[model samples]
Target: MDKNAPKIAIVGAGVVGLTVADILQKDLNKANITVIADKFKEDTTSSVAAGIFCPGSSFRGATLEIAHRWIEDSWYYWQDILKTPEASTAGIMELSSYVFSKEDYGVTRNSFIENLVPIYRSVQGEELKICGPDWKYGSYFTTVKIGCDRYLPWVEKRFIAKGGKIVNGKIDSFTDTSLRQYDLVFNCTGLGAKYLCNDSNIFPMRGQVIRVKAPWLKTAFFGDYDTYIIPGLDGVATLGGVRQYDTYNLKVCKHDAAAILDQCSQMLPDLKKVEIVAHKVGLRPHRVPVRVEPELIGGLKVVHCYGHGGNGVMSAPGTALNAVKIGYDFLKTNVKNKI
Candidate 1:
């Protein structure tokens, strides 16, 4: 290790943190990187996400232009990886999805990804009946899904190979740490940010899903009430979910599970017969505008990059890239003066 190189610490192990670590190692190769997080792999919310690339218009930043830029940058970032040979191993796969709405036309419209994806078009008269009767409006689009089951491990492996260190520990506070020790600290602690920064704006949106062995199903489907059927690379499809606001209940709710089964069965009746693989519950760290800014905390150069809400996996890379730039600036200015 070069003693003159900057030392950086990333405080979360979810997709956001890992993605930041990945790019940082590449962008600043001489810097010493350490990932300190309490949870990793399946334990983080990044693993629980269905990992779809589509983003709702509601997912935003401080401004509309910044929000649009994040989505566009993220789309092209994943598209570049999708073309690589490691796509499958990295859990990046191209998937076509159908969104249907019986009453609200707005449910079928996605302004954020309409023009970004390769194919986005309204369904025809006969195609409306493809799922079942009572389908009024629908849209068929081609997109990509990132299965975190493989992605998290893949990224971690690459990070370690690039001389990055992984430290398993829950960060109690930012100011409590040795501020002058590291050049910069990145706060990417998803739901953990609630306590770390005492950020009242951050809240948990509980979601539950059932994974089933359904190889026959290829395309993804999204109906009302956050209900979705997303197929992964390993022939396992993720059927989900319910968005319970301000709910911290990680237990599998029987009522929510029953409703998911009923709604999903209505879309693909054959799903009722598929064997269940597993059930998962996650608390999405949601905020009004996903936070991505630099703050000086007790003389520590800290860049905040949490509050990804439900679209963490979808937009992790873009946000990570932005965080890296902020961190680099902090190191060059504030931390350099202290050191």
Candidate 2:
């Protein structure tokens, strides 16, 4: 390690934090980086997600342009990964998905990626019947899914190989003395930001999903009530789910499981015969506008990049890419001020 390398600290180990570390390791070769978090790998909420590329209509940054860029940049980022041999090893895969809603045609349409993805169009009347005879409104799109169960470990391997350090500890405050020596910090704490930043605007949007062994399921299917069935690696299909706003309970609710199974089975009758793999729950850190900005915290330079809610896996790369650029600029300014 260079004796004078910039000492950088990232205070979360989830997808957002690790992606920041991954980008920093590549962007700033001489930086000594450390990832500090209470949780790691599969223990994180990121693991609970089926990790599809679809973003909620409400997902946004400080501005519409920035929000669109995050999704656009992320799509291309995954596209690059999808072309490489590491795609499978990294748990990234392509998916052809259908989103349908009996009550609203708007639910089937996504303005964000209509022009970006390979396909995004209204589904045919025959296609609506693909899920069930009662389905009315639908749209078909080609997308991507990232399995954090494999992705988190894969990225960690790459990060550690590049000389980055990982530490397991909970951070309750940005003013922690241990962070004094670091030249800058990146707050990718996700839901923890609600407490660390003491920002009431950040709230949890709880989600629950089920994993089933259905080798026959190749494409993904989505319905109203946030119900979705996304296919992943290893013949595992993620069936979900409910979005309970302001709820923090993480335990698997039996009621949720029964409802999810019923909804998913209705979409694909064959799923009723699939073996149950697991049930997972996560609290998405939701905010009106996703926070990704610079802050002066206790005389330390920090870049805040959390509150992605349900879209963390889909948008991590894009926002992390932006965070690195902003952090690099912060480092340059810090150097100039010291000199």
Candidate 3:
């Protein structure tokens, strides 16, 4: 490492933090980037997600335009990766999805991604029967899915190739970590932010998923009760889930597994015959504004990019791109910060 090079620290190794490292490394080729996190890859909350590209209405930012920009930018980021031979290795692929509602048509609509993805249209009358006969309203659209089981390692390799470092440890606080010694730090710690920043507004949105070997299922399906069937790069498909707010239980509840299977199988009956692979639970970092800004905490310049709730995996690249922009500006102006 050069004695006077730009030293940057990024907290959290989930998709969000790693994406920050990836983008920053590309943009600031000479900067020293270190990714510190207690958990990695499959152990991360991001791994528990189906890694769908569809952003719910709840996915937000400080402003409407900012939120819109993040989603749009993120789509293109993944699209670029999807075009490469590395797409399969990177766990990035395209898949169409159907969102159905038995009661309200509004549940089937996604304003955030209507125009962003390559395809978004109301489902035909017969298409509703594709999932089940009870579905009253539905929409079909083409989207992307990322398999973090493969993505994390793929991105880490590139980050390391660019001279980035990955460290293993739990970050107790921004001021408490070795990151405080760096010129700039990006706080992408997700739910850990609740304790790391003492933020009362940010809480856990507990979610569960059941992974099953269902190769025949190519399209993703979203039904009521947070139920979804999202296919991955391999033959494995993720079926789930429930968003229990403010819960911290990491243990896999049997009740959740039963409900997820019951609901998912109801939509796609063939799922009942698939081999069960795994059950995953994640505490999504939920925040109202989806924090993505700068703070000078005890003179330690930090740019936060967490609180994507369940959308972190889907939106990491864009939020990370934005966080790097802020972090770069901080690094340029702060000449005396020490590490």
Candidate 4:
């Protein structure tokens, strides 16, 4: 640690937390950094995400411009990383995906990433036959997927190598620690923030998925009704899911499992025969718009960066970069300057 550097702590171990740590390390080279979290790796909601780069139109920031900036910044951040040798090990990969919908044409369109990604265009008539018949609306686009299973560990290792520290314990409250000890703290604790800040706006959007061996499946597919088959780095592909609103149930529902299999098999009948690897459930920390701002609580400076919903993995870096800028501004605060 640099003796003159400011001491900083980041709370949370998910993609958002790790991304904040990564950016902070780069931006504040001399700062002493430590990541405090009760959960890590597979324990995080990030791992459960299919990690497609498509952000819903509903995903927002404090303002529309801010939202678009976050999305654009995040895309380039991953694109830069994808060009490196560590891309695969970091679980970053270029992916081609097909979005199909029979009811709503808008469901097959994405304004967020349509013009941003490398490729975005209407699917050709023959391309519609790639999945199955009767698909009225369809679009094909090239994007990226970050497998948190690999990304979390990869980032954590890099963080530590760069002189960052990790403390594995749940932070009950920001007031639990001395405010003066660290210059600032970043709150990236996902659903944990609901309790930490008593935020009612944040709720859980429950999701369930099945991981199965399907290396032959190279492209990603999203059918109607939250049904998706996303291929991962390994031969395993994720079949999902159910977005039960305001539901915190982490236990996999048998009914959801059956329904997922039914829907996925309908898209590709061969899925019915794929060996089941595992069934998992996670509660996405959902809010109207993702929270990314600085707050002063009980004399401690903290930046809030949670409520990413299902798009956490895809958007974490962009939001984290913004959060780090806020944290830095708070640390350099003049007594009369207001945040």
Candidate 5:
């Protein structure tokens, strides 16, 4: 370790923060790095996510081009992992998904990932009836699914083994005295940025999902009204969901669980008999364009990398890469205390 290595602090333990930490550790070997967060494995919104690589049409970066780059970069990052023998242990795998829409064909088409995935085309013939007579429009795409349940801990172990420090703590604000020692800070606080930076554009997009024991179900499915069925490792499939924008409620809503069950079971009758595993609610940190820029705040150099909404799990690596790049550049700039 270099005695003059840069000291860095990461503000969240979720997918984004950890991803940033992992990448930075590789980019700046021997740089002192610490991950500070109030939550850990199974507690973060990332864990509740189905971890499918399918990004919604609304998911974007600072621009359409940037957004596309993030998705493409992420695809290849996971692809590299998928090719490794540790893929299953790392909770990364290839997955095929079918999305059906009863009313509009547009709902079935995903412009964001259609060209990126290996296979993405309209469902035809008996395929329409695969999900119990969808009878309208559909598209089948082969993508990847990440199960954060295994991923978070796996990456954490790697980080710690590489001498990265993990602090089970909360950061009240960017200017909080605890951050004074670090030469650079990466603020991947997700929704917490709404208060930390008082960013009005960032808000909670509440989402809920139910995990079930459906060993027989392998492929993923999506239907109208934000309905989705995603399978993960260990025969545990995720059924979801409800997206209530600006809603901050985190408690598990019985109504949302019931609705998710009903909707998912309707698409795959076998889900009706699947054993219930757990219900999860997460407030997605949503903003039109995710924040991945740097600033000098109160003489501290920081890179903001939050507001990924529901796409954080799939897009973490790409955005983290961008954040680390910005952090490297910011590290060279002489800091001048400013508001």
Candidate 6:
């Protein structure tokens, strides 16, 4: 390791921060990189996520073009991993999903992935009946799911083996004394940015999900009202959820669990019989046009990369790549004006 290389600090150990760390280490072979976070693996919100690649139509970046690029780049990044022998250990796998809506046809259509996925098309005649006769609209598409349960540790091990440092600590502010030694910082703190950056736009969009033993379920399912069924590694499948905007409650609500179980069971009755493995809650860092710009804070060069909401798992790589590009450009100049 070069003792004088530019020091880079990455905050947050969730999917976003770790993804940025992984890519940064790969892109800058000898750059001193450290990942600082208070939580890891199962303790982080990313662990509770369904990890499906399908983004809600509302997922956005600064603009439609930027958003499209993020989705496209992310799809190819995961695709590359899926083709490798280490895919299973990395917790990435190809999954075919069926999104159904009984009310709005628009819900079944995803503009972000329609042209990107190999098999994204409308469901024909009896295809809708597979879930139930009442289903009026549906679309089948191929995508990937990243199981952070396995992915976080998998990436962390590779990162450490590559000489990347991991620090288990909390960063209360960008100017925290602990960060003074670093030349640059990448802020991927997710919802924690709400307080750290004084960012009012980012808030907790609480989501609750239940993991169940359903080895028989191979395909993902989505119904109206934010309900979804996503298969994961092993025999565990995730059934969820409710999107309560501006809600900060992280404790699992039995009522919400009951509703989720009822809704999911209605779509696929077999779910009612599956053994419940765990109930999880995640407070998504909901923000429109996800923050991905550079700023000089207290004479420190910083690049912000949080606010991915529920799409962080699938979109992390692309946005992280973009953040790295901006950070490199920012590093080229010595200007320190706060922006």
Query: Which is superior by lDDT, 1 or 5?
Result: 5
Q: Which digits, one per residue and each the tens of the lDDT, describe model 1 over residues 194-225?
A: 99999999999999999999999899999877
For model 2, residues 109-144, the per-residue Cα lDDT tens digits are: 999989999988898768779988888899999999
* Top-lDDT structure, candidate number: 6
Between candidates 4 and 6, the one scoring higher on TM-score is 6
Number of clashes found in candidate 3: 1
**Cα TM-score of candidate 5:** 0.97
lDDT of each: 0.89, 0.90, 0.89, 0.90, 0.90, 0.93
Kindly give the stretch of ten consecutive residues in candidate 3 with the minimal lDDT sum: 330-339
Q: For candidate 4, lDDT tens digit of each residue in 86-170?
A: 9999999999999999788999999888879888999768788877888889999999999999999999999999999999997
TM-score for each of the candidates:
0.97, 0.97, 0.97, 0.97, 0.97, 0.98
Runs off by more than 4 Å, candidate 1: 178-180, 335-339
- RMSD in angstroms between candidate 3 and the native structure over all alpha carbons: 1.4
- Model 1: lowest-lDDT 10 consecutive positions: 330-339
lDDT of 5 by residue, 1-339 (tens): 787998899999999999999999988888899999999888888888889998888888889999999989889989998999989999998899999988998989989898889899999888899988645998999999999998999999999999999999878877788888888999999998998898999989999999899888889999999899998889999999999999989899998899999998899888888899888899999998999999888888989999999899999999999999999999888775232
Can you give the lDDT of residue 299 in candidate 3? 71
Model 5 segments beyond 4 Å from truth? 337-339
**lDDT computed for candidate 3:** 0.89
Q: Cα deviation of 62 in candidate 6 (Å)?
A: 0.8
lDDT of candidate 1 at residue 190, scale 0 to 100: 90
Runs in model 6 deviating more than 4 A are: 336-339
